[model samples]
Target: MEQHKYSISKWCTVSEEVVKRFDQVVFEGEKGDFVAFAKAYYKTNEIDYPKFFKMDALSKLAFIGSECLLMDEEFDKPTSDIALLFSNASSSLDTDLKHCESIIDKDSFYPSPAVFVYTLANICLAEVSIKHKLQSENAFFVTPSFDGDLMYTQVKYILETHRAKQVLCAWVEYLEGKYKFFGYMVGSYRQGELEHTRENIKEIYRR
Candidate 1:
């Protein structure tokens, strides 16, 4: 396949809010209302979300953000090599806590199955794929800390195998209101930038 790297195909960015709202509908305050809070910037006097959809805030953000980026793309049947890779140091600690809290009291322990799902980082991918119909091969890895090298290798293998036309890679960690999201899409689009091998991905963050 032809390698094109330098050119950026599509790109967009969103944010965490004071509360995670679904479809602009408000959600519980504890999970990090950051995304919800950020909604204010986009909301105007004439436009506001009818209801927030916290169903899967993480994935919802990816779906909405990625789609908005590719809105004007003119690629021919573009396969979303746009793989999704997310990392969180907290590793769904909040979700686990919520679940444990549910069963902590044997007297009235009842775990909320819905909250149980967000405990895993990969759920973000599921939501993004479901929303955008992106079936590209991808992964979700967790670490005590961020290691750019680890990310580079995983992305490299995907490109080498022709499994991805591009990658929507990122670092999305959430615990309480204090969370971090660092992501970008990589692929062959530049006239000569497409040779996105392991080193290419690794070297990306070097500068």
Candidate 2:
């Protein structure tokens, strides 16, 4: 058996602070609820996408994380050749609760199409794909926790099997009023890149 090495071209973490490539403090805003933080991050950063406001909390987190992860990185392949692999524990529970509440009261049941559309966790993947114009393979998983082996294996397979030239991996989880997003890019080796391994993935997630 042999192992193939891939590089983590870049990564981003969005929580109380926005850290890019591990330690660079790109933006740090006042601590607040997820909704407030998302709004402040988007507005303060001047991300020119008005559609962001329409997305659900999970999608919004994924969108913002993807935005910071893919910033200024040139891809060698077309957008269609990039694959998205995202996993989270909450699995869109935040939006699911909203949708559930809408239908729970039959007397006043009025489901908004907007709210119903984001019931699935994978919808966040779609939101990111649409925003970045990525037409490549994308999948989302719900795990008990952030599985580093899952992230490493899935990303490695995507690269080795030629399903994509580059793979964007993320662990975007949002439930209730808490959120954490960790995203990274895995691809062929490049200068100053971190090797894509299970340990590395866990380390980055912890950071």
Candidate 3:
């Protein structure tokens, strides 16, 4: 298997001031529009509301990771063989709860098929591709817990045998109105350049 260039960023950062323990995290804003949610949480010069480019924490992870890849002036738009390999601990728990709530609210039993589709964690990647026009193979991995070794191996195989030029990978887990997004912008250019060790990933999430 080949290696790739990797860059990472963590957001919706919880303040270390008011809280001492880091087991649980809290968001700074309530849900309305996620791009606006992102704007309120992180600072970036490329952001414009109309651009409304990145929505949801998972999308935000891809947006920031994509920015890192697009940074190389020599690189061009990824044409094909781009794969989205992602792993999550909670596995769309937030969206699942939303779907359940919609059907179980008693007063409102209508289930919009659209919302139901997004209830899958894989929808995050689909949304990213639609937002950025990436027509490539994609996959989502759900695990009982975070395992960096498993994620790294999946990405490597995807790139080698699956012919994926890039793997926008992340550990995005959401639960109880809380979310944490940690993405590694992995690709052909930065092969063997990243330390995808368990400790490193744990550090990424401050876990």
Candidate 4:
């Protein structure tokens, strides 16, 4: 059997105070929260997506991270050939809390479809796909922590089975006002400067 190898072609990380692409600082927030930083980053980048403001925090974080991760890469393959694999700890609890509050009061209960739509954790994946026009396989896993091994295994299978020419993997966690997003593009070994390994993934997340 031939061993298949995959590499991380590009990576991006976004925290409340900073954004880094390929280990270089691209955006720095002045000790602000994720919301403030997100808006600032959007303005600085001049992103024309109007719906970005309407998305819940989880979707916004994942969207900004994906925007940075997939930026400037012209894909030779069709958009359907890219897969999205994301995992998170809070699993949309941030939005769940709001949704719960909206319905908690029976008399005042009026759940907004906009808020209800984001109750599912996987909704972030859908938002990203819509933004990027990716008609591809996508999955969102809820884990207690970042599980790089699981991501590696899943991406490996997707690539080996020709399900996708590349996979975009991310760990996007948002709860309350805290947010962290780390995402990378995985493709053939020749496509990247670094090998796709659990260690490398952890290292990038740490950075």
Candidate 5:
């Protein structure tokens, strides 16, 4: 059996203070909350996607990360050939808390359907898929923390099994006012400077 190899072609990281693409700092946020930072990023990049304002924090974090990763690449492959796999520690807790607050009081029991829709962590994956028109295998996991081993194993399995030709894997988390997003694109061909491995992912994330 031939061993399959994959490379991380591009990667992006977004936090409350900075957004980085690969090893370069693409965007930096001023002193403000996560929401304000996200808005500033959107405006600075001139992203015209109006739906961005309506997405939950988790989705917004993932969206911005993905945007930075794909900014310089051309997507000519079939939409179904690309997969999305994302993990987060908080899962959708931030939005869930908001939802809970909306329905906490009986007298002011007003559940927002919009907020209710984002209670699931996988909704972030849906938002990315919808934006990029990706229709491949996608999954969202809630790990206690960043697990590079799990991400590498899953990406390898998908590629070896011919489930997808490319994958967008990420660890995006948003809770309270803190946020962190790290995403990378992987493929069988060597289009990146670094190999796709557990240690490499962990090292890059830590940087």
Candidate 6:
């Protein structure tokens, strides 16, 4: 059997303060709040997605990070062949807290269907998939920390199993007032700028 090799074709990181792509700073802002930073980023880039304002912090972060990473890449394969693999430490706790607060008081209870929909961390994946028209296999994992081994293994498995021709993998987290999102595109062909390895994933994440 021929060995299959995958590479990280492109990557992007978005936080409360900056948005970076391929080790280059694409956008920076003074806002210390995650929500504010996301809005500023969308505005600065002239993004007119009305649904962006409705997303929770986690989804917003994922959407922006994925958008930045896919901005310049051309997909020759069917969108359905692109898989989405994302994980985070906090999961959807940030939105869970808000949802809890909304229903904590019965007298002043105000349950919002819109807000309730974002309680699942995987909603971020849905938002990205919807935007990019990606109808592919996807998974969301929650770990105590960023597990490079798990991510590396999963991507490799997906490729080997022919589950996907490409994978948009990311670690997007939002907790308290801090937020961090890092996304990369992976594929079997060596058309990427970075080799897809656990070490390389960690290095770009740290940057």
Instruction: Estimate every model's Cα lDDT from 0 to 1.
Output: 0.56, 0.84, 0.55, 0.89, 0.87, 0.87
Candidate 5 minimal-lDDT segment of 10 residues: 69-78
Q: What is candidate 2's lDDT per residue for 1-207, written digit by digit as tens? A: 545468888888877645355657787767766777788889987888888999998898898888887767565554877899999998988998999988898799899999999989999888888777788999998999989999888988888899998898989999887888889989998767888778888887887
Deviation in Å, model 2, residue 150 alpha carbon: 0.9
Residue 114's C-alpha lDDT in candidate 3?
Answer: 55
What's the residue-level lDDT of 166 in candidate 5?
Answer: 84
Question: Model 3: per-residue lDDT, tens digit, 40-153?
Answer: 544444543343342444545444444433334233454455566767777777667777878997787898775576667787777656545677877778887767777777
Off by over 4 Å in 5: 1-4, 75-78
Q: In candidate 4, which residue ranges exceed 4 Å CA deviation?
A: 1-4, 75-78
Where does model 1 exceed 4 Å of error?
1-32, 38-52, 56-80, 189-207
lDDT of 3 at 95: 60
Model 2 misplaced regions, further than 4 Å: 1-4, 17-20, 74-78
Model 5 lDDT at residue 1:
56
Instruction: Output the better candidate (1/6) by TM-score.
Output: 6
The lDDT ranking, best first, is 4, 5, 6, 2, 1, 3
Instruction: For model 4, give the 10-residue run with minimal summed lDDT.
Output: 69-78
Which candidate model has the greater TM-score, 1 or 4?
A: 4
Better of 3 and 6 by TM-score: 6
Off by over 4 Å in 6: 1-4, 74-78
The window of 10 residues in a row where model 3 has the poorest summed lDDT is 13-22
Which 10 residues in a row give candidate 1 its minimum summed lDDT?
A: 19-28
Point out the higher-scoring one by TM-score: 5 or 6.
5
